[model samples]
Structure formats: C-alpha cells, structure tokens
Target: MLYVKIHELRKRKFKVAQIAKELKVSRPTVYKYLDMTFDEAKAYTEQPLGKKRKLDPYKDWILAWLEEYPHLSSAQIHDWLLERYPDLVVGGSTVRTYVKDIREVYQIEKKVMIRQYEAVPEQPMGKQLQVDWGETKQKTTDNKEIKLYFIAFVLAHSRQKYMEWQARPFTTRDAIRCHEHAFQFYGGRTEEIVYDQDHLIAVSENAGQLLLTTEFQHYVNEREFNVHLCRKADPESKGMIENVVKYIKGNFADSRVFSDIEDWNSRALQWLQRTGNHQVHQTTKKRPAEVFLLEKQHLQPVSSLLSYESTHNQSITRNVSKDNTIRYKSNRYSVPLGTYQTMSENLVWIEVKDEDQKTLVIRREAKGEVIAEHLVSSEKGKLIQNRHHTRDRSKGVEELKQRLVSCFEDQGQAAAYLDEISQRYPRYRRDQFAIIYKIIQQYPAFIDTVLTKCMAEKLYHANDFRDIAHHLHTLRDEPIEEGQPFYTSSPKHSHIKASTRSLLAYTSILGGRA
Candidate 1:
C-alpha cells in the first residue's frame, strides 16, 4: 500500500519531502520505492537480512567469549582481542555489531537479577554527601596505555560533584587529603559523609562495629563530621554516587586523551562546568550549578585550624638527624639524600596512617610536598630506608675505595686490606673507608706504612690506623706536604702500645645491652 502511495504521489507531482511528510515516511524511502517497480520491490523485500563477511573469520571465538562470560562488554571484548592477538586489525564498531548478532544467534543473554528498591526521598541541602572511588584506562599521546584512579564526591541534595585523580592507588592519608579537596570544591561539607567498605578507610566490619583506619579516624574526629558506611554488597543504598562513578567513566574519561593526571583533572573541571554541572538533571529538572547556589548556603564551614588544606595541615615536627632520617615511635624513616641541611633541629613533619600504624608520611614542611613515605616498622629501633636515598653514598663509596687502592705502592696489600675490612665490617664499610680516606689525604705516605703494618698484623680497623698515623706524625717534626714522601723512621714506635679492642665487642655492644 505504501509503495503504491509513493507511485500515486509521484504521478500527482508531489515533492519528495512533501510526499514523505504526508505519508510519514522518510524522503530517501520515497525515492527508493518511487523508483522501484512491483517485481523489484518484491525482490528487495525478500533479500537476506545478514551476510557473511570479514568478521566471519572471528565469529567462532567471539561466540565462545560471549558464551563463556555473559557479562563481558563490547569494549572488553575488543580489548581482549587486541591482547590475545596483537596484530588483529579490526574496528570496535565492527566487533560490536558482530558480537550483537552472535549473541542473538547463540541465544546468549546477559542475565541481571535486579533487586527491589524503595523510593528514596530527595535529601535536603547540606544533609549528606556520598563518596566513591573509580578508575579508567586512557591512551597517552605516545599511544601507551595507563590506568588512573580517582575519588568522586557528590552532594546528596544538589548532586554537585568534585573529583581527584592520581596514578597510584590511594593510601589512607591520600584519601583523607582528597576528601578535604572535595570539601573545599563544594565550599564546605555536609553533616555526614558516606562511604563503602573500602579497605583504605575501614579496617574491618566486625558485626557492625566499623573500625576505621587510624589516620582517617583521626581526620574524622578532628573534622567533626559523621561517617556513614554503606552495607557490604548493597550499592543501591548509595546509588546516587554509584551512578556518578559510571557517569564519569563513560561520559568524561572514555573520550579523554590523558597526558598526565594533573591535566586530566584540570580539564575535567571544565567538563563539569560545561556539561556535568550545567545540564538540566532528568530527576531534578534543574542545573546542578543552580541548585548548588542554594545548597552552598547550608554547608558547614571548613576549619583552617583542623582541616588538611593546601595551606595548613596539622603535622608533628620531627628533627632530621645526621643520617637524613626522622624517628617516630622508636623507628627511623629515611628522607631523600641531602635532605638534612645540618645536624641540629633540621625538621620534617611526620604522620602515621592506618589503624595498625602501617604507613608513615614525611613532608619537608607542615603539610608541604611529600619527601618520603614508608611502611612503619613493627620492631623498635629499626631503620626503614628507601634504596634511592643512599644511591649517592653507594657511588661515593666506590670512588673512595678506588682512590684508597691507588694510594698504596704494594697493590696486593691495599686490595687485601680493603677486602678484609669489607668482609669483616660489611655494614660499616662506608664509615671505615670514610675515615681511612681522610687519614690518607692528611698523611699520604704514612698510610702506606699503616697498610703494610695492618696487613702483617691482620688489623683492619680504620680508627686504629688513624691513631698510629698521628702518633708517627708527631714523632717526626716535619710538616707533611701533598707531594712530599712521608715516612716514620723511629724504630722504638714499631708496635708502640697500639690500643686494640676485640672485634666481638663491636657486635656484642650493638645488641642494645652493656
């Protein structure tokens, strides 16, 4: 009937657009049927719905993947194909269409068991905030892939949101810091902050006893806000934030090309302004920015004295020791090399995080740029050091050892002396070489004599060599110069009451007892 109507309309001199409007059909449809005879239309209607082509090669495996994992998304399937066969040349749309058809043919359905939910009344302004963590993969400019983690916060009343991203998984201190940043973005916080059972914040849910991590617990107490942890596996209780997580991943991050985390988040703010916050919400029928204007008036004021803002953070000062470490709770944590300017009162602030005190964060200033972070030691007086911190010292020790070996005339004696010192005092080799290097610089020729004496007597201690060199230097009244050959000829000083202590005394004394 429609094909005959197109013929009659064309005979009546009806324009394509006009005919399409009158018959409520498309202009292209009118043209297609207008040019077709009865026999041609019959053949067109009887054509096959689908045809085999390029994707037929992968049809079997694609069908198998869908049959095995019904929950796999088209994007995930595309990723898997690329991962399994790196040289597979296929577009995402091509795979999507193929997967859809394969699913229908194999009767593979993605089953979802929906739970019943009660209608939740809209929260009033400043009443509550829902927070959740999300992550996504993005392509860098160089076409390399990187995964980024983020924490998102949404106001329960207005749906105004804030987000922060980092390349690494968040620690407890990091989570608290992001919370403060979100609170500032929203101008203040709600009366209650909602969370899921994130291991970063909560230690355990012991029969309903919420044991929050110690760092976050301190922050909650100091910030004076209530915490609401959603029941495990029940995301519908905080469904608003869960939707926000999906919305962010799908709408913003999926289309973005990431250069770095800072740039990714910086541009996300513009997206929020241009689309996320400005668009009229489906439920509220108002822009989030406009609703937030009214909601900001109800938010609680943030405290500069207590909150961990960019300007101020409540951190305890610890003096930097000569070894470039700070002591906290009987353990020493290292800072970057050269962090210690002087031995006396050079300070860095330290904070212990997690309920078990598992982590330590150290900063150059109170809440300033982080210089070091470490796992807190369980044993007292343990040194928790970052290997990179002592890399320079390692290099310097190598150079010093080379220079000391060159200073000796008998190379065999010099190598043997060094080998014995290193093997005997492995941990203190650097300090030993440091003292020996100084003594060699002061009395060049005299050190050779000490080396020969130490080799014959098998004495490998550096301080003893230093004292013997000084004693010989005083005996000879000649001032030692750089290029002048130094020697001690007093035969009476050949083993003149050189003070010595048993090597076992060093290890026994270090056992923390007399």
Candidate 2:
C-alpha cells in the first residue's frame, strides 16, 4: 500500500524523490511502482483475496460436508455444492484446489520424502550374516498342542536363508544344534554371524558379563566363525534375518498346519529354497539363491579345524545294593564285591551318552571282566536281580579300574589317577587290584586313607591293606568284657565289717561304709 500510494502520487506529477521520502521507500522502488497500471495495482492488493479461501457461505458448506463425509471426492463435493447454490459459480479446478487445502489441514495424504542421494558401494558377499529366531504353532498327530522354534540364518547380501526347527525349547543346545545344521546345510560357515543378543547366546552387562554357553562356544570355536551381537533394542543390526522371518511368516508358515515340529521344519526348508530364496530381492534385483552362491564363493571354506558336532552328554546315578551292584539309570552293574565291606557309605561312578532313560545298562567298570551284567526292561514287573550275571571273579578288579577310569574321563587330573596307579602296580593285574579298588570305590575317602596306611605299613600288596581294613573293622566293632574289676579287692577278709580306717576311706571314696 505504501509503495502504491507513492506510485499514485508520482503519476499525478509528484516528484519521485518526494514520494520516496514520504513513503520511506527508495526512489528506485517508487519509480518501479509508478510504472505499473491500475490493473497491476489492483492485482497487488487483491493477491491475498485471490489466494485466501474465505469463510463465506459456499466455503462453509464445503467444510461442513467434508467433516461428515471425509472420503467424498472433490467432484462429489463440487456437485453437492452446485446443487445448493444456483447463484454461486465455481469450476472443478477451484473445488479441487479447496480439497487440497482441506487435506493439508487434516493431514490425510501420504508424505513425500525428498532424499538426498548418495551412492553406497555393495558390501562384500558373506562378509556378514544375520540370525534370528522364528516361531510357529503346531499340533502332533494326536492333536497335542505345541509351538516350535526355528532358528533362521540369512546371508545379508544374498538374503539366502536357512531355517532349522526343533521340537524342544530354544535352549542353548538347540541354538548350537541349529547353527551346526545350518552351516552343514550351506556346505560351509560364513565369516561373521550377526545375532540379536538372544538370551540363549548373549546377555547384558547388567545381567553379568555376556557369557556364551559352553556348547555355543564349542560350536563357534570348532567352526572358526566370528559372532557379532547386535546392540540391545537394535533390530536393524540383523535386518536381513528379520526380513527373512517376516517373508517366511507371510509367504509360507502363515496359517499353515503341520503334524509336528519336524514336519513343519521340513516344509519350511523346502519353501525357503523354492519360494523365498528363489525370489528376486526388491532392491538388489537378484535372486537370493544367486546372491547366496556368490557369497559362498567369497566365504572362507568351513574351517579344516574340527567341525562342531552335536553332543548330548547325560549323567546317570545308580544305587549300590548289599552285593556291591550299582543299579544305574535302570540297569544293574557291579563293581568289586568289596564295595559291600563298608556299611555306612555307598557310591559308584558311571558315564552315559545317548542312552534311553528306561533301558540304560551298567556293565562291569573293568575292561576284561564283564563281572556282572544286567539288562533293564522297560516293563514294571522286571526284577533287576534276575537280569544279573557274573562273568568272572578273576576279572572283577580290572572292571573296577575301567569303571574308575570312565568316571574321571571327563575330568582332567582325575583321569590320570588310574593310568598312574596302573603303571606303579604292575603286579596287581588291573583285575586283581580292582578288588582293592572296589573298596576305594565304596569308600572313596579310603583312596587316600588306605594309600597312606599302606605306604606307612610298607604294604605294597592289595591283600595286605585288605587284611588291615578287616582288623580295623573288628576292633571298631569289638564287644567289652566284664571279667576284671579293679578296686583294691584285698577285700578285708580279716576286718570284714568294722575297720574304721577302711570305713573312712571307703566312705570318702564311695560315699558308703563296709
């Protein structure tokens, strides 16, 4: 307005310098304003009026109708408005413009992102891998409800995924088992595997220093694979595996039914290779399997180092009956019968692997003598005693040595105890010595005690310590004799009833008189 005022004044022959001074605008600007026609001046003042959607009657109806029928199109609104106002004139374009303005107020349309582009070089294939756990519901043949866990591993660049499902809980064992199977499935292991800090593999500092389970460490060390854990709450760290899980859920496992976990997993693997791995990645424009093969080419071969194999070690305990037989798990196995010598203590050692809980056996612990063998029946009526058979008494001691060796096999220094003992006692064939060893087995504390006693007595022979132990047992259980009474039994045959001196001593000593 100030510029226009000055311009109008200038056109009426007012001096430009004077108009500039009055309007507080520059002289050039006043001249520029003066150059404009009446229509231009009107256009400048009318700009706001042209652009603004006025709160007039027709605009009011449009706003009200929009609140009620938000989905109505601009044309629909235009037609509705035309019906109401015969005098009010507007074009489709005007109505469209108003619809856009209303949308901005309501914030309904999808946002447009203007990305500043930067080129990211493709990552080296197999340089990184991703892992995650997925779950699907299943039912057994008998309609038993169950949920199965699948560990998903995917190559980041290729998106080639391997899935392994287990019927059991996602324990540390299951995790390692899955990894081992996945590596075997790929014919090799990747250089680096990214994990989501899954509780089975890694825990937080707050929880304690993140410690991988021994089984998991064994797998990683054996395979020579580097494990990288994603920072907590950072799902994008293993985004490839996460995406694979989503893809599987949507394309394959979603709403799918299976007989059991194994069945579900078999179908999942098939689907992954056929449907998921073969699909073209939206961004990479390459099939996952193609990229995966390229990744495999770049990967270091599965280390020539020992491959991690699944190990299922279980411990079994058995009771030693009066006959020195250790009924472990369910089978009756015997140590040296000398185990029964010690009445107060009883324990036997056995190592078991991959045996059914109900039918596990305890053969003689010694090598040569299958001293006693017992077959365990799954039935309830089976008598453990009926199954026992003694192979040879002469080999019983050797069996005990074998048993002891087997007991300490998993331990370090203890494993060498038998080997060293065997070397020292060459005369005591492992079988003969096993008898004395059975005593040590029955009384493990006696290993040191008998050893010390034997050394102290210079008793190199097993029979010598056996004799000494028997003597100690006898003395320990000896009965007291009541024959000898000692109390000055020169019992006064002479002064039978009335010696004052004797009476006083007796009274003082025994609180009584003769």
Candidate 3:
C-alpha cells in the first residue's frame, strides 16, 4: 500500500519530499518505491519478509540431512553440524529456527494432517471390540532397560478395555492367548473383533481382503467369531483400541519399575481395575466399569463360544528326520526308532499347549499314537532326545539270552546255570552267551564239569569259564597210574640201558684209548 500510494503521489506530480511527509515515510523509501514499476513493486512486496541468518550458508546441507533422515531432531542436526565443521559454533535454538525455515521453504518437513473421522453410529453392547498392540522401552528399578509389548482390547460401545503386558514381542500363540484372556476378562466375547494388519494374525492383504495366519485362523474358527482387519496404514478403523494402546504406554508404563514380567503384569491388572476402568472415559463420559456392567449381559456367554481348552491346543505337522527326530520351534525332539522307519512322508502331528510351562505332545498322525512329549525350550537350536526311544540295545540283549538258553538245552543243570549267569550279568550277557556257545562248540564233553566248577567258585565272568575248561584239559593230558605211587623225584637205577654199551664201542673205535 505504501509503494502504491508513493507511486500514485508521484503520478500526481508530487515532490519526493512532499510525498514522504504526506505518507509519513522517509524520502529514501518514497524514492525507492517510486523508481520501481507496478509489477516490480508488487513482486518486491511479495518476497519473504524475514531477515537472513548466519545459517543461510548451510541451508542446502540441512535440507539434505532432513531428506536423508526425516526423523532426526533439530538438536541432533545441530550437533552434526558442529562435528562436520570444526570452526562452526551455533546455538541449538538458532539451528532449530533455521531448520524450521528451511523445512518450510522446501516443504520437506512432515506435515501431520489432523484427519476428522465421521462418528460411527454406536455399536450394540458386545457387538464389536477393537484390539491392538504397542511397544515401549523402559528402565526397571534396578536400572536395567527392557522392552515391553502390550496388547489392548476395547469394547466399541461401553469403551470397556483390557490390557496385558509382556517383556518380549508377541507371536501368533501369544496373540491368541491375549485374546482368550481379554474375552475372559469381559466374562464373554464380542461378535466380531477388529484388528490392524499385524503379522501375527493378518498374513496378507489383497484388494481389501485379508488372509489370517494359520494359527490365528484356526483360533477364530474354533471360537466362532468374526475378525475385521483394518485397511493398511489406517488406524481410525480401530481407533478405540489404538487409543487404548497409547493410554497404556502413557499411563501404565510410564516411569513404572519392572521387577519382573509376571509382577509387572499383576500390577498392570490392578491398575486397570483401580484407575483405568473406573475412571470416566473421555469419549463416553461414563465409567467404563459401570458401563461394562450393562454391556456384560448382551455379550456371548463364555461357555457358548469354543472351550478355552480347544482354543489353546495349537497343532502343527512336522516331518520326522532320518535320525528319528522332528524339528519344532528351532529344537529337535526324538521319537521311537521305527516310528518313521518305513513311512514315505515321515510326518507326525505336534500339538502345543500354552501353559505356565509350555509342552509339546507329538503323535503319529496315521495311527493317532502318541510317541513323545517334551517341555518346550525357549533356547534355539537344541536337540532333546528321550532315552526310552532308543531301546534297541535292550532288545538285542533279550535275543542273546534266548539263544544262550537254546544252545545249552541238553543239560538241565548247565542250561540253568547259563540262564542264571545271563540274567545276573545283563550288561555282559552277550559276551557270556558267546563264551557258553564257544564252550559247547569246542568242549562238548566238559560242559557240565565247566558249569559245575564255575557255579561252585561263584565265577560268573566269561573269562572264568574259559580258564576252568583249560585246566580240565591240562589234567586230561597227563594221566597217572592208579596202583603205582606218583614219582616225587628222579629215581636212581642200578641196571643201565643200551647207552652204556654205546660209550664203550666209541672208546674202542678211538684207538683203544680206554
């Protein structure tokens, strides 16, 4: 307006000094405006009104940083600039101001549009419930940092909410367990549950169609409840539960000391009962607990849905390896040796039950025969073998014992002795049976004597029987006369044999040297 008035006064042939006084402006300003065309004056007025700052030199660099890391804060960028340029010293506030201007100039900063969602007509009590999960990191009383994940459920009408926290991320089984707990907390279930596109439940989405994970699909089928998966990146569809997740992190988890997962969960439950549910909800303007009382009657009875027992019985199929083992949850479990011996597929059914201590029950799907049960391990890459599954060594011992009994059947006492020794020394029964079989093969006549001596000496070892048989053979080799006394020493004989005559003949032949 000043420039237009100055130009018009000049067009009326007013002097620069007079125009300056009339417009209450300086002569230099009036003359400066009067020198410009109308278009140039308008363009000059439309220029950015702020003055240049020291950071004007690094505007491109700041924009580049923002483009690379949009989540970087202004303070972080200021620190980065100090590190990049050793001589550059700038205040954090100055950097922040410059970054704000740069972001506006380039339109690089994320602009969060406040979306207005049309108020959905109120759902009937127990008709719909929204579920979601949120995560945050916190420090415990001991100053140990831990990440916490929480699952929250909110009834659409009454705004009744249920929430539980865990120290680790959730799996499909955990999600299902949370759902079961939420339903039990409400004393019933809703007709349909709304959820975001979480990988634990929603596997994939195509043209607004969702395919649920296998375990979640089975859980929903058993429970007989409809599942509503919100569109991708859209939280407003399940905004109630989303808000509950935030409320839990802000209210229940903030500055909370986590001694342990179980204790923390217990306290979280108490918090929900005392503070979360009892407080007047912001939207409904009624206490959620009070509203839940009226909503409870309309919900599907807990007993009417699938039993909790079946909902938690998650079953999967695993192929048995050549080592008679099956892999489950990164661990290997053994079955009987012949369980998968001849099968073409070598597949077995594994049913996992979520308990205080989780357990895996493996069964032969073909015959519905349970082969093994084991406590599930949290550690990865472990091999858990059942000792009873490898009984082949014991069966071999039994076969050896039967052979030993059949080999010595002719002599009752010998056979009984063999059986006794075999049964007594089961660990070495195969060796004992082999020794007995060898004796029967080599010393068929001395079997009874060897057995008798062995039993009398209380010698049950295989080498003991072999020594006894060898001694008997030595006695048989040197026989003694019955009537004559055995010679105790060398006997002296007066009458010599023909060796004396041979010595005299040799002397005569040596030229009568006698």
Worst ten in a row by lDDT for model 3: 480-489
| Model 1 lDDT tens row, 198-243 | 9778978877788997668888888789888988898989988999
* Candidate that scores best on lDDT: 1
Supply the global lDDT for candidate 1.
Answer: 0.80
Whole-model lDDT, candidate 3?
A: 0.77
Per-residue C-alpha lDDT of model 2 across residues 1-514, encoded as one tens digit per residue: 5545775686688897887666555576566557767677567444412355542346557667777766778898888877886666787897887666554333334244454645445667767778899876755566665676678888777777788876544766566666667777776777888888776786443433456644477677777787787778867656667888887777786667668666677788788778888878887899988777667877666643344333342322344677766644334555554555565435343444345453333433312233343445455433465322434544666566666545432333333444554666766657545566566555453344444455544456656656655554555555423332211246557756773565577678987755
Higher-lDDT candidate among 1 and 2? 1
TM-score of each: 0.43, 0.39, 0.45
Off by over 4 Å in 1: 1-114, 305-514
Q: Candidate 2: where are CA atoms >4 Å away?
A: 1-122, 139-144, 205-211, 303-514
Task: RMSD for all candidates, in order, please.
Answer: 20.6, 28.1, 20.2
lDDT of each: 0.80, 0.61, 0.77
Better of 1 and 3 by TM-score: 3
Clashing pairs in 2: 365-399, 365-403, 366-398, 366-399, 397-434, 398-431
